[model samples]
Target: MNHQSVDVNTAQSFVPKVSVVIPIYNGEADLPDLLSCLLSQTYPKEQVEYLLVDNNSSDRTLSILQTTAENSPITIRPLSENNIQSSYAARNTGIKAATGEIIAFTDADCRPQPQWLNTLIQPFINPEVVIVAGEILALPGTSLLEKFADKQETLSQKHTLAHKFCPYGQTANLAIRQHIFTKSGLFRPYLTTGGDADICWRILKANLGKLEFADDAIVQHRHRVTIKELSSQWRRYGRSNRYLHELHGIELTREIKTKEYIYILLRWLLKEVPKISIQNIIGQASFADLFNTPLGLFTSRERSLGQKKAQLPENAKVIEWF
Candidate 1:
């Protein structure tokens, strides 16, 4: 869909300085693509800066950043957050170094459209909008897992924005005003996941500002290509659920029952098995991946159920939102 551009005349002088912050850990393989996207961004380079924070990667991620800093036309700042291993910590480091009025975040494996930043920040023309989230679409891939991700729209902002209690956005395509951090506080540095939701909720709960969704601001995310990688992704999600529940008293979904497991198995055998053709039998198709979805969900729920309840973080308050 074509982007619906905001009328600059409707708002009081719209343009604002923007900082694009990305957290990287052993992202050497993905850096080239991400950098290419950033360089191609249609946003005014004079009004923007890129902060690429390295979370102490063991690979050549830092070296690549150093090279880009010297050669790139756009301003690139390479910072490090070695103390903590979490992505959120790396992001916080970038946040501290950002000088732009707006802080936009995207992952190392994500490729934003040329107009991503320009479109993302348009909603901020209204003074009340503190958070703006963009759409996340899966990049095309040949693997079954990747195909499944695309089919489900796994990383789309719609899921989180439809949260039962309060909406949030993934960091992959979110932009926030710099001052919001000062008021709502930065993300929990220790969280390996779910920090985005936590910080967004805190901002909303404090009534700091409004959150807006910008469908035109699109970012394409790379999906896990293998079953192992996909399983790990879901497992982290399960762990995140536990952390969120502990912090907010959010209700958790019960463990998958044995009956449901049997049903899934039956469906796989009766439905999915019939879809298998010559392309599938020769390992040239993704038809078989459909069966793995149920298994993934089952494992995720089991992981969530088995996870030990964690203690609340220091100075954290439990807010019961039903």
Candidate 2:
């Protein structure tokens, strides 16, 4: 409950008014840099309200949050019960408690640029835009696996930015109107992964408003350095995808297909496994990214078919994805 307000007189005046919500889960190592980036924003301290929602972290995350709150103007709220295990639930908690009209979200592991907040909120000047998704750059690491993962992420971001039909948004760098969540409900609590995509899908389905991509709104995503960490992360991502498909009525999309899945398996057998094995590498690693195309396609198709089959009868209670 430690609350301290920053003196704004000494800071810049052109602070674009916005509230930044960062959901923390065992992010003790990443907090200092993340908070330093926030405190260094071009935006004025008084115009911004920082919210840190601790998602029942077992580490020193809460202690860091408390320490940060005492010195900064950030509001730190510890969840009463960690009943909701997902980060999406933690974000929803922050969304419910946020006071600013323009709500910005980022991961505790992200370090945003100085102009990140300013640029993210710039698109809001046009009344037609409701959501603004920022660019996420991966932080530098020495590991080859880290580079590969980052490259994949960069390519995905570029693809999303290039396509008008792509409405996918990441929690790492996304902002939305406060009222959207208030009137439409927040993110789905059940989704442990892809909750950002699920939330964006719901927003688009409801025709809530237009979504814009902000290239200037940059946040550096700190990726895991080892193959073991990456494999576990991807597996969790896959499980989350399954949960999202089951909980939401939406499908993955047509780009992912069955043949692609086969190609992935073949590639792993022919290329990746041989390379790793020849090097005497023995770890739980993945060449999953090589198969993501087909996997995504198959998952999307399965989800679509499932949704079609699950269609409820008239007068039945409609399940809310959020």
Candidate 3:
């Protein structure tokens, strides 16, 4: 509730208010570190505000945020969104509650770089650019699933940009002018995943905002460490993504076949098996990454299959994946 409205005439320093919003659900364990990183940000304390929305957490997350805010140097506002059980819903709540001109978003598990906020809000200086897409890199990982997730994410972002996807950015590291919400609307509350891309596409397609990429504005994301975790997460993403494509009139050109998947697995094994150094691992790759080709292939297939199933009315519900 303690939000400072900074006006050029009111304050001599006159720093533009930048509100950083984060949505959390059962994030008690990670909130401390994320908060610590946020507190350490190089952004000006008087100009920055942290707005965190809790999605009916079942643990000590609320208390942790409240206690931290009490002693923190920066302005921290912690709110609760109990009506819905989705991050998008929490983000919407945060957006409505935000007092800053610029709203930056990240997750409870993500660690933003020191200059993340400064870099993200830079594009807004030009009135034409309303949305900024920051970089989401994987936190350093040694496990196979983690490394695979990171690699997949890197390729996916590159592919999205290369294909000229507009308003593209993950909420894990993104910023937008607050007025853009009133123009483009909030993220779909029903979607448990892919909401980030969904809103971005909507804003860009409607020509409501100009999206820019801020490569220097970065966040280190912790990818799922285990195969089961990765599977469930990607499956949810696939399902939500299918809903998104359908909503936007995007069509899949072809269906993946069992033989095609088998072929892909074979090709990977034949082409990748020889590149392993030491005990068959490429530079910086662990032994797990070298042997996880089959699992990675299977994961992709499951994600694809989930998307197909989600196209059906009977399988469109957003089931909790974690």
Candidate 4:
């Protein structure tokens, strides 16, 4: 690591070292783009270290990490977590190996904006703030499912932070003080889903610190491009909802009756469908976006109903959806 010289006459500036932890599982296709974004970050390279954790990947993910670390100007540590299949477990491994005071997290598929790290770390300048949740938006997509996901703001942190029990940020774009982990304990290594919520709530419960949102700290994520992929994503969310309810007493959305389901479907088709038009969708949407935006809600709800009758697994293999 290189250090910049500072004049002793004036007080030196405070720049907290940041460790970016990303957990990956067969992310070969998306790794290049994500790495490019990381390498192009506007943040001081000397102050940031990236820990890319591979969670039992069966692809060329390990090879890519090795190649990047060899040629990259920034510090890149390629680590592995094969003992547990969960992404949270992989993250815990990265956390243990991280050397920075403030640890930031993004997925292997997420593309951070150039100013992401610089803006994300700014909140920690205040003593009261311990967690920083950055904004997540979808990368532009060509498929109907992808456009629908983008229109719905599927990756937004707003809804997650608005949880009734406690506000929490998804791991896609979040930063936390390293000391908070020691006080709150690391994330439940076995949790395949809802681990972000679990950890943030634990920190708040322990009175360790508070969380903040950074609007300018942005990361773009690729949305699922097919119906099967979209459905799988919602199913995971449903299972997460069930797990969270069991752990934190968070209430699940009541199941709709047969009559109510019919009513909603009819209402959406009869009343809402006609309201959409080229005028409203000109610059903002495509034909896919115009039709799928309203229809996706029903599909998402039905897909998420997996939690209603789902059995929680003891140690489920974490699937990388991004």
lDDT of 4 by residue, 151-217 (tens): 6787899889888788999999999999888777787788888899888887887788778888778
Residue 40 CA displacement from its true place in model 1, Å = 0.3
- Model 3, which residues run further than 4 Å from truth? 1-15, 154-156, 162-167, 268-271, 274-289, 311-322
> So what's the TM-score on candidate 4?
0.89
Comparing 3 and 4 by lDDT, which wins?
4
Tens-place lDDT digits, model 2, residues 1-322:
0112224442234344577888888888887898888878876667788888888889988877777677766444443227667677778777777778898999888889999887787776656677888888888865655656565674234554453444666888989988787556677664556667766767776888878888767988867666456545655555444455555644433344567667776776688657766544445444443444443344345444543344332322222323
List the candidate 4 regions with Cα displacement exceeding 4 Å: 1-12, 277-286, 289-294, 313-322
TM-scores for every candidate against the unseen true structure:
0.87, 0.72, 0.85, 0.89
**Clashing residue pairs found in predicted model 2:** 15-44, 252-300, 256-297, 257-297
Candidate 1 local lDDT, 189-308, one digit each (tens): 877777889989989999998899998899998888776776677767766777788776676656677788788788777876767555587886667465565656655554664444
TM-score of 2: 0.72
Q: Mind sharing the TM-score for model 1?
A: 0.87
Error of 2 at 221 (Å): 0.8
Native-vs-model 3 lDDT?
Answer: 0.75
Cα deviation of 32 in candidate 1 (Å)?
Answer: 1.1
Worst 10 residues of 2 by lDDT: 312-321
Clashes of each: 0, 4, 4, 0
lDDT of 2 at 35: 80
